[model samples]
Target: MLMIFGTWASQVMSRTLHEASIAEKYEQWMAQYGRTYEDNAEKERRFMIFKDNLEFIENFNNAGNQSHKLGINKFADLTMEEFKATHTGYKSTQPKSSKTVSPFRYNDTEDVPSSLNWIDEGAVTDVKDQRQCGKGITILSFVSSYY
Candidate 1:
């Protein structure tokens, strides 16, 4: 779970950082004064730092606790949340027959409703999709206090 969290968190953060860097550069390029050599140089420097930070994050996944100094604990926490949303208790699928209740599958048959309704019922957000927000997984994780 930790490994999965680390990988996903790194991917999300990397993408976010890339987007932010691009936006920042675009904003600078569109300044009213127009672009200057020094402005370009400064932008490049900022981009380099962004790139290095992303690389550091990627390397941190394998660096054990070295990333903690860089405030990666929050990233790790986010990764764990993403992992829980997509995985955790996902191995078992709901059974087709009424006799067996599949703990894994959200919706088994017509009789039982899926806990997935929680996501659907709540206000949708950019952060998560309805199917990805598995209520059962959240419950188990919460009770177990894993994260």
Candidate 2:
């Protein structure tokens, strides 16, 4: 009976210490990402998302079978829906048109290369760092015509 009690007490203490360490990690992540909430409720909500994301990151990395791995970033505190809605703006409501378009450039499959290196072609823009500003990836599309 004494051994049983001792085991239970040790288990409880271990769990408490593990939880404390997790909470400390959350605090450090929040500080790094400059995350803040208006109230305790909001903080708790974000913390749940953050914890879920951390678990996913860990599991993905531990698998060790993939060419790439996931990591916690500035968007770690957000849910998938929240991140998409906020960062990936302009979801088209219109139905897809059954349109066939002809390519202006790279028209000939035989002439075209298998893959493109836009950087080598000097078509790519300079890399932008949004450190502390915390901006999401944005793509711009433009249609050109001779005026």
Candidate 3:
């Protein structure tokens, strides 16, 4: 009867240790998963806000002069400050203009790579009279040439 009691006691002790090891492992995994989830959520939020601000800037840039007269600079400065505060790791990834050309030459030079064969420069049959030249023409040329 003493031997039987010892055997039962040993089994119960082993089972308790086994359960504790499993619980510890489970807790460790949960902590790791929680950190990963939080990191991903933070990245997603930053990207979303960045995208929204970029779209607003693009639309504002495309607007006419009268629309441009609005207090966009003040708003943009405030928004940028807020964005930088929230997303501390954020940095502008935009590359500087590689073309060593002035605005006058940039629009005039047409010798783009042949690999971009999809750009149909002559296909633009119609544009408003005011857009026939200047910045719109430059933008159109760039878009058409890159295609």
Candidate 4:
């Protein structure tokens, strides 16, 4: 009985160490290539969920005959109910217009520029880190309007 308990304890410790190693690797990868979130309880909770999802995705892909390069670029930390409440309450009240406009016509196709580099023209704004605030759409709209 004592030997059996010792074996079980060793197995548990090995599993715990393996999990810690994976978590450490994930942290290093995040620091190198991913966006950093604030170090808080909420962020920690989201990180754990994200890690579990990533592992599940990796296992599923490996189990299949065909290799699918699946990955998680961002984590949706909010619960489904919370997400629905935040995003579904607002309804647009604007009435639709019945007016039609003629399509734009250009006379000289040769005069049209083939490509544009907004960054080279100094029209693009620097990337902003709006961590956990969810103001990406607003920022993008403001930047696009500048052009």
TM-score of each: 0.22, 0.59, 0.24, 0.44
Clashes of each: 1, 0, 0, 0
Model 3 agreement with the true structure over 32-75: per-residue lDDT tens digits: 54423257666455445434554576676667654453222212
Question: How do these models rank on TM-score, best leading?
Answer: 2, 4, 3, 1
Q: Give me the runs in candidate 1 sitting further than 4 Å from their true place.
A: 32-147
Which lDDT tens digits does candidate 2 get at residues 1-147? 999999999999999997788788899999998888999999988888888888899999999999999988889998987887676664655666889766766454465555665656678754556464454655444332322
Predictions in order: lDDT: 0.50, 0.79, 0.52, 0.64
Residue 63 CA displacement from its true place in model 1, Å: 31
lDDT of 4: 0.64
The number of clashing residue pairs in model 3 is 0
Query: Model 3 residue 31 lDDT?
Result: 57
Candidate 2: count the clashes. Answer: 0
**What's the distance in Å from true for residue 100, model 1?**
74
Model 3 poorest ten-residue lDDT run: 69-78
In terms of lDDT, model 2 sits at 0.79
Among these predicted structures, which one has the highest lDDT?
2
lDDT tens per residue, model 4, 124-147: 756677565454445442323221
